[model samples]
Target chain A: MTKTRRPNRAEVEPIRVATVMDVPGVIALDEEVTGLLKPAYWRDMFERYGARPGGSRVFLVAESDGRIDGFIIGEVRAWEFGSSPSGWVFAVQVRSRLRVQGLGSRLFEAVCESFRAAGVDRIRTMVAPDNTEIHSFFRSQGMMAGPFIELEMRLD
Target chain B: MRLQKATEIALYAVLELAIDPERQLTAVEIAERYGISTHHLAKVLRDLGRGGLVDSVRGVGGGYRFAGDAKRLTLMDVISLFEDVSADTDELPPQEAGQEIARGLRFVLTELDTQSVATLRSITISTMLKLIVRRPWATIALEPRRPTVRRGR
Candidate 1:
């Protein structure tokens, strides 16, 4: 006799975008995998980018067991954050234990699909030189490393 | 949905208090700071006092004290205080019976009534204040920078 397990229906629901309800849960998930950028900063980001016109900035959160396990925040900006030709992967992170099982890919593909629907033609992200693991993650997704490097300075 | 004029004014005024936070400033000063008017500023302050955001003192050396902190103050929280959400619901004009437009309108109005204030407050006083100091995008607006005043000999 041969038997196969049916795939979970809940997994077919697609990655869900962040609602006002998921802010704290998603923030906690982010803290587990990356340096904390402060709750206020995150609140500002989701509010501005999520509610932006044209549905350009999409924030998706993955949940399991009634808790956020990961999130992806991406924006469709033309030249800059809003300028037109591209969408930038502003941030995406998954819980440490859930890393290898496709949650990040689901979140990434969900964001890319949303941006493609928004008419965004290209995707970009600024990755640090030292983060070899994350660099490999992007490469595995068939993303090419461009020649341009991001540089910034704050004048006070 | 647009923020009620009073709510916008109060945000700017209270943020000014957060910046200064020493003593109360006059109605005219607050208005001028935001490029609003004294009459309008006073109206906003009265609303703030009603909402318990700022306390008023009478006479010389009396102005306004921030009854709250910037971190604790969400822009949404402040705007909601001045806005009458229930009263706004009362103002919906009844329309034709066939379409049920009122139901849809009520839904949108309710959403805006809740969402707009919370969104605005999400952008805190600190970011707005920083924008004032570093107006990098001022050039982007398509307005004439200098108006010519003809010199008469």
Candidate 2:
């Protein structure tokens, strides 16, 4: 008699470029990280940015045993705040159980490589100002605040 | 500030479902645990379902399940399902000398409400559940109440 054991989390598959097929799983993961379920937004992003490769956008996912455990989405933006183009990460999240294993850093670095390939020297991302965890993570990644500041008004 | 009966019920329902995410329990089961009416609980459950916090299944072995990851759900999200915290300037009376004190009172109340909502939003459902199960006496024991001495008159 023999017993089979599941592989350890560290031994799982490495990160790879995401595909159109990974959209559903990616959306599910996003909703898990962010409580809002915006299927239309995810679907549109897949169709417009992630369906094919070699665009200004970069979508990467970490898969293990054919399941996506983490994902990141980034793109190049220009002249938004009267500055040159730079890589802007829109979202990045890892499964709660699989966090702190460098999955987020791996995804971030992969996106940075893509941005480098696209001729951008700097990468940027927006996090809720009070989110100290994300702030520290970004700082650990060598990301610092740029010249711009976010301003908003609650219209309700 | 008192939470409405519906809001209180919704909070318990979410807590019960979050306690065991893998286990799907019906409204009746949750209401029984809390000693509340199942009829009213069903209505609250429907509101939760509509709020995208829980999903329902019909027929045999049917029940409501936590829709998303419980850790992602903040206490604010669950409370919003049963309470309308939407800001409305209409609540303020006409701006006049007679209502000056009333307006100032409303401003203070609104500020308190905003601050409390921010606090609730920062606390996730998972954090609340963990606190609920922790030994309450541990903190009390560490910080024993200081005995007050009466001065001789």
Best by DockQ: 2
In CAPRI terms, where does candidate 2 land? incorrect
Clashing pairs in 1: A77-A84, A78-A82, A78-A83, A78-A84, A78-A85, A79-A83, B24-B64, B75-B121, B76-B117, B76-B121
DockQ of each: 0.01, 0.02
Model 2 DockQ vs. reference: 0.02
- List, residue by residue over B45-100, the lDDT tens digit for candidate 2: 99999988888989999899888566557777888777866433566455666687
**Considering summed lDDT, which 10 consecutive residues are worst modelled in model 1 chain B?**
B114-123
Best by TM-score: 2
Q: Tell me how far the alpha carbon of residue B64 in candidate 2 is from the true structure, in angstroms, after superposition.
A: 2.0
Q: Per-residue lDDT for B22 in model 2?
A: 76
Q: How does model 1 do on interface RMSD, in angstroms?
A: 16.4
At residue A123, what lDDT does model 2 achieve?
91
Report the lDDT tens digits of candidate 1 across residue range A1-156: 889877543344357878777788877876766767478877887798655534878888887656887888988776743334787897888777766456777788888888899887678887554454565455445454443435566998
How many angstroms is the interface RMSD of candidate 2? 8.7
lDDT of each model, Cα atoms only? 0.69, 0.77
